[model samples]
Target: MTDEEPTRSAPPEAHAVSPRFAEYTDRLLFGEVWQRPGLSMRDKSMLTCSVLIALNRSQYLSFHARRALDNGLSPRELSEIVTQLAVYCGWPMASAAVSELAPVYAERGIGAEDVAPEPVPPLDADPGMELRRKAVLDASIGAVSPDLARYSNELLFGDLWLHPELAPRDRSLVTLAAIWAMGLQPLLDYQYRRAFDNGVTRDEISDALVHCAFYVGWPRAMAAAMVAREVLVGDDGEDHA
Candidate 1:
């Protein structure tokens, strides 16, 4: 006992976390969730922006609007998300969200340079992609009406989707979220599938829906979850990557 040191205390006992809740977090919330191998946080941000706008959840949109900035999302990208939703989600909702975000932009002192520049698509891009896309539109619209098909293809695919500034993944994520936010479950289903084709993964797409849930509601989250499960299981077995 001359100069013997006291024994160190054992590490704190590991408390048992609820398996039910743990499963929810691990399987539904975190596990492979949002961990789609190649997806980036920025891509998720674009999806969040579109869904929030579509659902008219300006409050959460305002919060994530800042989060997006912190995560390196550019003003231009945010602007595009809001603008793109304007056509589908409506102008009033997008405008309101913009108003909410104005103060955040001011707080961060984001200037012109931090803003995302307009994107440009390759001139020699594949023309066949358009025809293939119509297949998606036709599947979504079916025999009900041509308007939805035209809008999805001509406006969403033709104009906004072609922007080179934003990657196809970003466009797909945003479009899928917008469909979910608008309560267009059928369209959401198709877009969610298409998103995977455009290089988005189930994990990334699910997280976007989760982020959207913070703004929208549980219903939309469930809808996104359903889609994520289907896609993750390789039902389509197609990869946009």
Candidate 2:
């Protein structure tokens, strides 16, 4: 990742301020971990960007957006991600992410219309899972705010998640990143478990946690890593990867 602009990935003054931390950030995080084989660099970029957006860390978003573009995630696809995340991560941060990205798009002469995704029926047509989610929502938050439940069940899952813009696996990865980056550990078990259902592998989850360590900070990433271990690797001592 060659970032012309300063990003959290490789901070310019961190080395002078904290040499060892910087070395580990560069050599260990990027050098060794990122070079491992499971997740593509493109997926890493996308996940990182999503986490940053979720955490409202827009300062670093543009740099990673460039890396995402370099790694083959198209402008339209990114726009799609922003739209999806607006539901899951909230509209303001999603808007902030696009705020940084729009200039990158304009620099390349990519118009808003050019990046808009073609409409489609909701692709998340899993009735069984949909019903299960609604049931859970109804039992919990629905009792408090019925509208929230409807928006979550009827819109987020019924509509946005079903969209074909982002693949199920990619969507799962970014959603997991958002939950993890925000230090929302309770959601980790649920998201990590569902990630497998969405076709994200244990190894890829491992890679993602490591990737998040650099971008979101170690505390958030470490807590998420432990939760992933519990969720992905149970008492059988299995190498499920």
Q: For this target, which candidate reaches the highest lDDT against the unseen true structure?
A: 2
lDDT of 2 by residue, 1-241 (tens): 4333223455879888997787676767676666667788888888888888888988888878888899888788788778877877888998898789878888878896777666766564777877887899899999999999888887777777777878888889989888887888987877886789899888788888877787778898889888877766666877443
Q: List candidate 2 segments past 4 Å from native.
A: 1-12, 233-241
The stretch of ten residues in a row with the least summed lDDT in candidate 1 is 6-15
Q: What residue runs in model 1 are displaced by over 4 Å at the alpha carbon?
A: 1-45, 111-125, 135-151, 209-215, 228-241
In Å, residue 11's CA in model 2 sits off its true spot by 5.4
What is each predicted model's overall lDDT from 0 to 1? 0.66, 0.80
Error of 2 at 168 (Å): 1.2
lDDT at 233, model 2: 65
Which candidate number has the best TM-score?
Answer: 2
Model 1 residue 7 distance off true place after TM-score fit, in angstroms: 33
Query: Candidate 1's residue-wise lDDT over 143-166, tens digit each?
Result: 577887887777766777666666
Clashing pairs in 1: 76-116, 119-165, 120-164, 199-240
Cα error, candidate 2, residue 181 (Å): 0.5
What lDDT is reached at residue 152 by model 2? 82
